[model samples]
Target: MDKIRNFCIIAHIDHGKSTLADRLLEHTQTVADRDMQDQLLDSMDLERERGITIKSHAIQMNYRNGGDEYVLNLIDTPGHVDFSYEVSRSIAACEGALLIVDASQGIEAQTISNLYLAMENDLTIIPVLNKIDLPGASPEEVSDEIVDLLGVERDEIIRASGKTGQGVDDILDAIVKRIPAPKGDPEAPLQAMIFDSQYNPFRGVEVIFRVFNGTFKKGDAVKFVNTGRTYNADEIGILKLEQEPQKEIAAGNVGYLISGIKNAREVKVGDTITHVERPCEAVTGFEDVKPMVFAGIYPVDTTEYEELRASMEKLQLNDASLVWEPETSAALGFGFRCGFLGMLHLEIIQERLEREFDMTVITTVPSVQYKAVMTDESIKWVNAPSEMPEPNKCSHIEEPYIKAQIISKSDYIGPIISLCMDKRGILKNQVYLTTDRVELTFDLPLAEIVFDFFDKLKTISRGYASLDYELTGFRQSNMVKLDMMLNGEKVDALSAIVHRDKAYEWGKRLCEKLKELLPRQMFEIAVQASIGTKIIARETVKAMRKNVLAKCYGGDISRKRKLLEKQKKGKKRMRQVGNVEIPQEAFMAVLKLD
Candidate 1:
């Protein structure tokens, strides 16, 4: 067998992992003479738009060193914490990993988490300090930090500017020497881990995996160990890291399979692929992925509910991490309660659902996990806005908490700490970096920071702040489940459980924002805030009286009357409480801060 090296590149957000991959492909002459697409691993438009690696991509290249040819199977993993589970799965498929750290920014929280994951997997780690050509390039400091924090030897850090292609060859050389070749029995029973998958209308379910042991050629019958579903592999191909596909792939290689399996639900990530006749035991280390954040996703037009469902189903086929179930709302009609890894993942999914599927979505307010203790002595987990029990119905409640790390310039330390404190953040530790930058660690409730913490941090620090957080756990605390009422009628979709101290402030803010965003209708609208049965605050939206008064002067009275009728019909479609027509924008207004 050829000397093959299977390794994944891990990094924090904006650490140049994809850029470095492009550089590697260019240096290896993997790109064809006429092919010219930047960030080739970012195949999807959504991936490029977000500037995040949503999908983990694998590519193969031939490297010649000392007149010896070696094959490199390089996998690029997502840098965001939302896709951390996917990152772990991708790492498990590789024999080694390239821990790419930003030269100036040093190691981030996600970077550390990814490093710990690689260590746990026992993968050979090749430390690479990327972006060495930037104005603030500090390879020496980053190198020292790597040695100090990651326990890597000082001499092991590979310095490279993925942006300028400087010192890239050195990185490649280190990869060849530091990362070990994949070691598995090619003759053993066929076994592979399904790290990622997708659905193509022409090819059906495209299952991408790294063969751990044994391999089979085309026409091999394989069984998914977890699902017990069998399929005949009609074709197998490896991504050349360019635009074309290779004919065959083997053990220690990353590739995709066309098994004619149309159902994407059957082919799940972490599922073991094995030969049907002689299947190997399922691989260990796979864990059930639980989505930490959820939002009610609905079609902007109620008629497109089926289309939205189809789109979500299609998306879920390849993205096993995405969770969705049927959900309904009086305001949004029928939709899905989509669960995501985190806020970023939720945004990406919503954006893709609209852009890729050409369907407008009405997303409900994002909700974090809540632990409810019932008066009947029952424990339950609640995530939906409509599911939060009334304050009087609960004996006790707890909100999910997270451990957050904020790195900022020393000058902005006061503002950052103040912002965190206002959100009920408790400082766990603090460290100074150099003389001007400081890193503050806090144990804060996820509910507090989920809304606009990052935005506020940017505003306060003038975009000099970088933050990272991980879900710590839950803490028992006094909390109240607050509800929104429109003209004394409770809106289940607008309810939330907040800390008792901040309830009035949040309620007033939400009601005022909703009134501002909700356009005036044919009748007066009242936005009310409620705690249990008592109303705390209210805002009035005056009825639109002269919306079509200008049209009468144009001598298009029929058109004017039609427009008014359409407006009246649109007003009728809205949720009416007393005299108010609550627009969809009113519901969305709660997301923004005053």
Candidate 2:
């Protein structure tokens, strides 16, 4: 156990975490030269194309130092704020963390938040200045920032470039010297915590876990404490580029377990796995995932509903942060209301469903969860606008609010502040991190940032700003449910809960956007945006006219009138019975509304 060191890499987005990881793997000879590639730990095609890590990857390495062999378990984590929960879980399974900071960018909002999380877990922090090979790299400036953020000595901070493999040996040496080895008793009862999982169609669900105590052997009878289900361990192994099967994995090691459990819900992340005969106490579990965004996902064809549900179940096994339940919409038919960490997470899930499962789905407009208090003091959680009660029956509505932390150049502070204020943000505080860099704090509605706020911030800041936010509890707000009506029927899929002040303007913009996306029909279509009894905005899609007088060019006046009357009646009848086929583009129009 003294030669075993477990640690994870944590950083802000695009800070060279994965690149550094590749260099480490190469130096340790953990992966063969023929197998090595950039961002090697990022196994997903979506991750590689987008240049982001959507999932946490765990791998083991064997490194020798001064005649002594050492085992290193490195878990690479996502840098995006949406996957912070993944980082948290990775942090929990390790004894130390490598805090990587981009030399040119210095410290950003996500870096600070992830640092705090590491501190809370009491993990040893090793500060490393990455990307020093960049022409814009400011190693000295970034070194000082890391010192101030972590309060570590100047000499302790390692300057390395993940691209050119500089200082890779030093990083390995530091891990062996600085990070403490995992401490556990092999004699104790089996107690391993499942940190991550993925589904295998041929075998079953594969569970990746970190063993804190006892031993797990192949063919051992194991049980999940949370689910109270037992199964024979079909195979046990340590995670590598490929899962290397082992007869047994002892305490203080990270490995995988397969028991032919076909059901996804049978293996829960953070649940304790123990031997059935001599089970240990269930270990304390990690906090539950708190999804920031809620949206409905439905099959394009109603007949594929069961297939969609099956696909979601398999996907959830891979992404434990995703949550969902069955729901129905008047316009979109039966669907599932799925919860996600943020809009980016929602998009990735939707795309993965299409690419991996070949499941075509329609995602409704995203919204934040709100609490509605009734006149009788009953509290109800409203995840969708359709769930909101009537204004008279509800005492007040409490919407989710977040404490937003933004780090950016001081030059763009004015525009940033204006954008936040426009989103109903209240400036809480501001501080100067350096001569030109500033950190601003604001209290804003979660719903405000659910749409184009991130895109606008990136545009205004010239991609120099980084944001991280946490829920600060619900607050009473003047909220109203804005409904969109096509013709005369209210489309529940397009409903949104908005602040009273912005409802009218938002409704107007949305109505206009729908008008542009919805195709013209044979009959006139009325696009109306309303709040309860009041019609806030409206637009008309005129009916396509085919001249009935073309056949009667020189007919009598009575004959022409009769043709016109017949056309009018036909249009009215068509309008009454015809169902508008809302194109998929129209469902996502709210996201593009300017």
Q: Could you say which candidate leads in lDDT?
A: 2
Q: For candidate 1, lDDT tens digit of each residue in 1-594? A: 457888899998889999999889999998884684777888889888778898888888989988888888888999877788778888888878999998888877678788888999999888888988889988887787788776878878888888789878987888788778777788989988888887788878888888888986778888999999888988787868532445555677778888888665677788899998888999888776788778888887888888888788888865678888898887667888888887778778887887878888877888888899989989888888677776667888888898888877889988888999999999989898667767899989988876777789879999777777778788888877678877567776777778889999989998888877776766667788888777888998776665656646767568777888977776655535334456677666667655
lDDT tens digits by residue: candidate 2, 240-272: 899999999989999999889898878788999
All candidates' lDDT scores? Answer: 0.81, 0.94
Which regions of candidate 1 deviate over 4 angstroms? 242-248, 433-435, 545-581
Indicate the TM-score of model 1: 0.91
Candidate 2 backbone clash number: 0
**Whole-model lDDT, candidate 1?**
0.81
